[model samples]
Target: MGLYPDDIEAQASAIITTYRDRGWLIATAESCTGGLIAGALTEIAGSSAVVDRGFVTYTNQAKMDLIGVSAATLDAFGAVSKETALQMAHGALMRSGAEVAVAVTGIAGPGGGSAEKPVGLVHLALKTRSGLVDHREMRYGEIGRDQVRLATVRTALEMLAAAAQTPA
Candidate 1:
């Protein structure tokens, strides 16, 4: 695996400090980045107070089973889609006791490129207990698979940090 980005570490630390101080917990639902978001969070000491758990739903079945991602949504919009990302984030909130949840679905590949959903296309969604959802779509252009995944992780961390800052 490639080196995890420094900004991700900083973002994770900030998130931990913010959430730990606020007595808030977080969860993650991941696809292309696997569990890197969770990994980054856990890399920080004392993250247990902030990180509740992680769902590494690398497969469609895992996504549906672990986080309640709808099969219809996956079939209709495909896995790496805004709709799926939204579902993943919401599902994580439902499944965990976390106040904030972040989800990432993407095509980080050297091979899985299409005309529309090309490689390095990532969709991130942040869901809060206040019933607000924020979605971001990133096109990192066909950077190497590790680079794309790291970029996605960084974006997810930023979203989580922002969501933590939002007033509940």
Candidate 2:
């Protein structure tokens, strides 16, 4: 069986605790995974200190309007591309005043898949004062939409934890 949301919540709790101990704050910019990353972090009590905020920018327009993702980036790289993901992470950091930020965008669909980008394709980006980190993941193609989202959330939380460790 796949991991549950609560399990992801627990992981996020650990992440928040670690970051809080080190005096860091985090923000999230989400697309296909919605606010699952932020929701997982907030699920833990006293997450306010570590979790600055979360932005659920599910649409291209929202990404631009809410997070300052440029229209040029979106047009040049598409919403799911690493370029857009990096821009989203940078935008979240700029808007949320967090020490670190994580962004996720992808085609999590049973319907939106194409030959180049499949249904389970996910792109994650992490931004810190030092630099940006990015990852592209393709989860098991057979899993349903819910499972794909869950996988993305877990990966995002893990990335957040890793990003929190970076010196700001």
TM agreement with the true structure for every prediction? 0.96, 0.91
Which stretches in model 1 have alpha-carbon errors above 4 Å?
1-3
Tell me the lDDT of model 1 at 38. Answer: 95
Flag regions of model 2 displaced more than 4 Å.
Answer: 1-6, 139-142
Clashing pairs in 2: none
| Tens digit per residue, CA lDDT, model 1, 93-158 | 999999999999999999887999999999999999987789999999988999999899888888
Residue range 1-168, candidate 2, lDDT tens digits: 123456786788799889899888898999988898887788788899898989999999999999999999988888988888889999998898787889999887878877777888888888886675656555546477888888988888888777766666
Q: What is the C-alpha lDDT of each candidate?
A: 0.91, 0.83
lDDT score of model 2? 0.83
Worst 10 residues of 2 by lDDT: 1-10
